[model samples]
Target: MSTVLQPGPARRKAARIAVLSGIASVAVALAGCGDSGTPDASQPTPEASAGPSAAAAELVVQDPWVKAADDGMTAVFGVLVNDTTADVTITSVTTDISPVELHEMAMSDGAMVMREKDGGIVVPAGGSHTLEPGGDHIMLMDIARPVQPGDEIALTLTFADGATSEFTAVAKPFAGAEESYDPSTEMDHG
Candidate 1:
């Protein structure tokens, strides 16, 4: 019988390295198996992307009415309701009737006065925000024409995310909402 030859130490070491390299190559190939360089259909499209905070919630104005005024300043009152679970902010308001400003009543110099609201009005998630007299309201200054009773005013509200919503507010007769920037004893309780 022929004598059997044993593997040298260097040859054994090279064999081990070769085996390990083969295993590593297989692992790398398996890792890249499923991805075909194609997009998955399960992923959301660009239009309907992300969570609630990614989109602005549309606000519904319920019982919207503007205080009837002839020429000068007046106010718009309503209950801004948000049906979505996301909270929204009314940053600014625009109308053809007059210049609009978001205002609130605050105590200044030991008296109650109307001032520009710091920050915008926030409508909570699945909740409501009131734009009423003597509290928080949209002030219409220097009206273009006389707003008599039964007139409808068109307004567009700009949200915090630059989204806009258009709504029509009916004019109603009201004797309240007389508070000014100066100190006034009269307060609008409406």
Candidate 2:
């Protein structure tokens, strides 16, 4: 006797159920692979980027110093650091000196020459400028009083952006003709 294994209704229903179950399983697996919309405490948060902020204007004076016992004149030197992104122009400079002038040193005919400057120094964006001896420096002419060591002179620097920065340039004896002065010198000016 030959038995015919033909597909029955029960077998067809089972096959459909198996196919549906397989599809449902695949869909659930795919959904699980995505984010669960929950925060993870184990991971660290990212830090904010470092850059200049709006409404933030700052000037940092480094190694600021003034010559002691002025020989009718004195000079101040420092590094002006503008942390703002905008261009900073020194519009005006004021000190105790009678005639304060901005001077620039240049080499002419193999000789160093100093000339009176019209405008103050310009601090560019994300940059710094130095006002040191043998370079662009501040000339304190006709010094009214002797600026000895440990004396602090108030210097008001006005900017083009309607901002004013006040710095205290400490007075100290010139270390040498080439060596720079220490901004934190505590010598007794008395």
Highest lDDT: give the candidate number.
1
Across residues 26-141, which tens digit of lDDT does each residue of candidate 2 receive?
A: 99998776666764456333221122222124668788888786546678889988776665677667786646767776655665566676577787777899997667777776
Q: Give the TM-score of candidate 1.
A: 0.67
Residue 98, candidate 1: alpha-carbon lDDT: 93
* Candidate 2: worst-modelled 10 consecutive residues by lDDT: 181-190
What TM-score would each prediction reach against the true structure?
Answer: 0.67, 0.59
Which residue pairs collide, candidate 1?
Answer: none
Report lDDT (Cα) of residue 155, candidate 2.
84
Task: Give lDDT: candidate 2, residue 4.
Answer: 91
Error of 1 at 100 (Å): 0.5
Q: After superposition, how far is residue 105 of candidate 1 from its true place, in Å?
A: 0.7
Please report, in order, the local distance difference test score of every candidate based on alpha carbons.
0.80, 0.69
lDDT of 1: 0.80
lDDT string, candidate 1, 64-101, tens digits: 99988777788898999987767888889999979988
